[model samples]
Target: MKMICMAVMLFITLLSAGAQKNIPASDIKTAMMKATRFMVEKVSNRGGYLWNYSPDFSRCWGELEAKPSMIWIEAGTPAMGNVFLNAYQLTGESYYLKAAQAAADALIWGQHPSGGWPYMLDFSGEISLKQWYSKVQKGYIHCAQEHAHYYGNCTYDDAATYDSGMFLLRMYLLTLDPKYKYPVERCLDFVLESQYPIGGWPQRYPLRYEYVKGDKEDYTSFITINDGVHTNNINFLLACYTLLGETRALEPLQRAMTCVLALQGGKPQAGWAMQHKLDLNYSPGHARDFEPAGYAATATAEMCRNLMRFYRWTGDTKYLARIPDAFEFLESIRYSDAQMKQLGKSVKPGQILCPTFVEVGTNRPLYLHNDPDHYWVDYDYHGLITHYSSTRAIDLQSLKDEYQHLLSLSKEEATKDSPFIGQTDISGTLLSHLMRGKVQQADTQKVDSLLTILKKKDYLPGRLPSVSKENPGFSDAPLPSEVISIKEYMNGMSTFIQYLTK
Candidate 1:
């Protein structure tokens, strides 16, 4: 009996040791080099990038803000910027630093006087300057007369300027460069002011409260929910609070959470709307003719997660307590497997169809669309280019998993949600290790091996992200190869190095 017990203990000890020592430092270094090469060789243009690149190493035209000749896609800029930062830290390489700095300089040049970045940046000085001059004539920017600035509509729509601004701030923190600091500060201030008095943010600021054209109008100046705007905005605030020690950040965050809490609608079926009315009421508000005010499962799930994050950061029980209400609404609307079968879609048994939007009170799914030619459905100037709004039935696996995890959590676990919580798995684990001051003894052999796989496939610049969308109506453009997305490259390599090095 004694011998059997001893054997069992020995086996357990061996298992623990084997599980922990999975990564190596040397392989991580090699992965870093290959990723750095890709960023420098294939990802960059004249100090900027097209929104997405093709595998064939050809530049793709911008999808939203990209132009054929000289546009820098804003969506992917931060990914490249952070990759350069990681390379510099990993190798102490001046080459990576130079690349990172040049991107910073471009960001500075493109910084709008309104304190945000445009969707895309055009590097051709004369064209950008001339455009700003046109805005100057309209007095959109008082300083436009003083100097030409990139004045594309400063927006937080779909994580626009906010993401770009945060990346610049991260760079500023490490490099302590003056150029990065000024824009970061201004952008943050703009973000703060963009918050509506009701504590939610408009997709764009200085508030284009209503969209009116051809006798059709709807309010757009309300708090936004699409693309995780509220969650992303408050996350930015939390980042400032945690890293910058910006105490003033707390007020806006609290107000924003309070706004979210109040706007959860009413009983048995209370969930969040995609866009809440601007009057501080809980009622759903219209956005673009097709996106009728409706309860959004995607936005609600994200908000609950972020609220838990806020509660963790603030020790504020209010944020934690508010999550169950959201959970209930999500539960009430679950699409049963039988119903999914009727749709005849390839859905799994446990899987549910989380409608992109649902009827506010009935908890029924909402379907909507309108010809943009007749109405001001899109708030941006490029509204005509958007496809008609369509209903989306997305996989609810992630949200379902997160909901179950939240149900099992104690207060202690709730507070642990963070920026690093849901990032790339290996990188986030490495960050957790580094934060604990455990790097010297960490098991890097496994992580290094994993990174090697990541380099060959993820960091490979073989396929371009330029899809066959009509990005430009009239341009002598070459055909593009359908390949892995910019996200795979950007998120894959950028996050890996940031976690390992930072």
Candidate 2:
């Protein structure tokens, strides 16, 4: 009788704990609204939303980076516009509609000649003819990058076909413009034609272009083929095809998905590497020429995320079947306690090809940097939180528990006499806690306090801080008194908002 009573009591306690885990919808909405407004205010300007805007309306960057501009326009602009769209949907506010239209106009103006966008743009109307060629040459680094740049440039070459197609698809969806449909169809046809016999798209088409103009034609041919199915390219292509509801897309997507599956690293493997004319070997952890292989984890995770979406749209069991493998791959790369202690909380993980990092001291995987590149890994707090929210295999309860652990760990680190003061990781960890949906009112207050400190210190500026190797400062970069360009920050914030809204 005593044992039975004890067991029953324990069960009830667990049930109560589980019940308490859910965050109130009202509270979530409030926090989300506040954060959204803060982000929007940081990006918006008289012309439109600049990519990045500091809290004081000074210090923005990448208003000129054309590629980022298109990404912002495609990913972020829609997000901000959607906020108003959502408002209109719920409350029938004309103000939201006006804001959405303005955002759309700004994005449309950012488009390049080829119906594509450049990676960067000079917001100043001072792009010379020489600069134009320079931008064009740089844009041809890879098919996807070129496409991104091309879409911004408003060009209609074969290079811009895939990304341009996606943009067109989005435009068609947004404006119900029949004009977009023709381009989208044409681009899809081009993409299908470009696929290799092995069922993969190349990193870039006509790959013979040397890195330098004077260099010997690297492949001794006018057209060089980077015929490998990269994760991003494959995902984007799959997404476009899936969106188009094209029967042709199904096979290619499946093949690409399967190929990605075959690339998974473990004791037991799936497929072997194939011989190709172009250097197709890009793997994780091997430090070679500029084409490093170690940036696979995040890529794989992103691909899986896209595949999940593809499955969602197509209801294809095969796409669904691959989810577990991809999930397992993500799990395997998760930075363990051993890995965390090895990598440290301050120093970013060495060339992370993985999605989630094991929070220091707690050993729970939380999404952090997507790339191993120092400049690129500048504390992607929003991406991490978004990935955590989107992951289906990982239960919400586990996420909340891990988030709490990360929060406690961050608080502990902040109080310590550590070297990494005003680092973005601190903010990222705090953001993770907020996203966990389990923060107590007191904890939320603490987060707000820390955020205030970070904001006042100008630590949240979107640009990479120039750290001195000889004498690193408390903060990486000085706060700008005048506003920088707005492209990068607006684009980044908009990307974050779009992900959340979706």
Candidate 3:
């Protein structure tokens, strides 16, 4: 038995050595360069990208069907730009830097006159965009009821502005280019000027309060926390202050933190809603019928995590103070077996699973079902919307454990690792933060897998996400079964970059 085990061990070692010998680092580098060039030159729209695109480049999408001229600011465009910068950082490649610069230029051009980005931009011009808003966006009946009208304003929703700002910040720090510098300052000014008196920011600035939800006014002007509105804005400001020595961002950063504390619901219901009114009350079911006026389970969990982050940043116990109450609130709202069965979820005790939205005062779980014509909300978890997560899993114990861990740390220890503190050399600081835990250990197997895929095709093909309708109101062109995805390319390139950096 001992002899057999030794033989197996020797065989495994030889296999590992042979695998390493077969795929050289230069081969991986060459493959990454080829794949990246294909994405940048062929798939990209003026050095920008959407979520995915048809191989023939005839069709594309961000949140919806897009004009070839349109680029998404949400996750697609900024994230791609970041990947390009990551490549440049890793390889010292001027082509990657040029690609990143073109993306920055596109973002700069798309920047609203108000100094932020829209969720989507039409490079074809405003007339074409307005037409899309009236026809395609308005007609596409999905969860995006918010896009039914074009406010012609900049948004903080879904990290749109902050992501764009952060990309520009990185560009400026890397090159010290005055062009990137001006936009970064403009974005900071926009964030500062748009902040509410109570320290929260509206979903959109230069607020247009026209879109009505039944009887309530549009929640776009409300203090939004949905999709990390405050967290994203505050983090961007913090980065700006820390990395750029922008003193103007300091006060707003403090105010934003305080506002997050203020936004917590009172007693028994010490949780959070997606958005809050200008008066700092829980926003009504204004955004969507499915997203009713309630303490959102996912939002509360994220807020708890954010509070922990804030505590780490400032070494303040105040941020940790309400976390226990929030966790307790989450614990109280744990779903029953019947509710779980109705929602098609298996019951697991000691595992905190519950409905996405809890009633504001009563703490009862709320489930929703919607069709093209109407939306219904009830205690019944059956027939919930396929578009949204009607049920959310909360990590009460993990949160509690994390809280204790934070509490264990001394003040200096807690604040020392914060990006806002003791960080010098913008490029080094940004790269470390950006590439933190990214390929800390080499995964040659992953590099091998990625190289294999690249060898088969120049681009990765992935199914289009968030496509609800067959003929999604935008164009007569048929949606492809799958497309060359910006996300896939980013992920693949990121793996390559991480492998190389390691």
Task: For residues 33-119, write the lDDT of model 3, one tens digit per residue.
Answer: 888899888877897888877888877778777778888898877888888888888889899999999999999988888898889
- Summed backbone clashes in each candidate are 15, 57, 0
**Candidate 1 TM-score, true structure as reference:** 0.70
lDDT of 2 by residue, 1-502 (tens): 9999999999999998776544343443444344445444444542244344444543333322232222244233534454444444444445545565555455455554333333333344334423543554443222122322222222222223333344445555556767656655655665565556555554334322343223222221211112222443454455554455567766766666555444443322111121123334422221112212233333444445544444433344454454555445445545455654544332232322233322222323333333322212222334432222211222323323433443354443433421123333333333222112111233333334433433444223345222101111212356543343333323332332333344
The C-alpha stretches of model 2 lying farther than 4 A from their native spots are 1-49, 53-59, 63-88, 102-115, 121-126, 129-171, 179-197, 202-208, 212-248, 261-291, 300-340, 345-502
Maximum-TM-score candidate: 3
Each candidate's TM vs. the true structure?
0.70, 0.45, 0.91
Q: Rank the candidate models, highest TM-score first.
A: 3, 1, 2
Of models 1 and 2, which has the larger lDDT?
Answer: 1
lDDT winner, 2 or 3: 3
For residues 170-214, could you state the per-residue lDDT of candidate 1 as single tens digits?
777777877787887788788788887778887666655334533
Q: Top model by lDDT, which number?
A: 3
**lDDT agreement with native, every candidate:** 0.59, 0.39, 0.80
The pairs that clash in candidate 3 are none
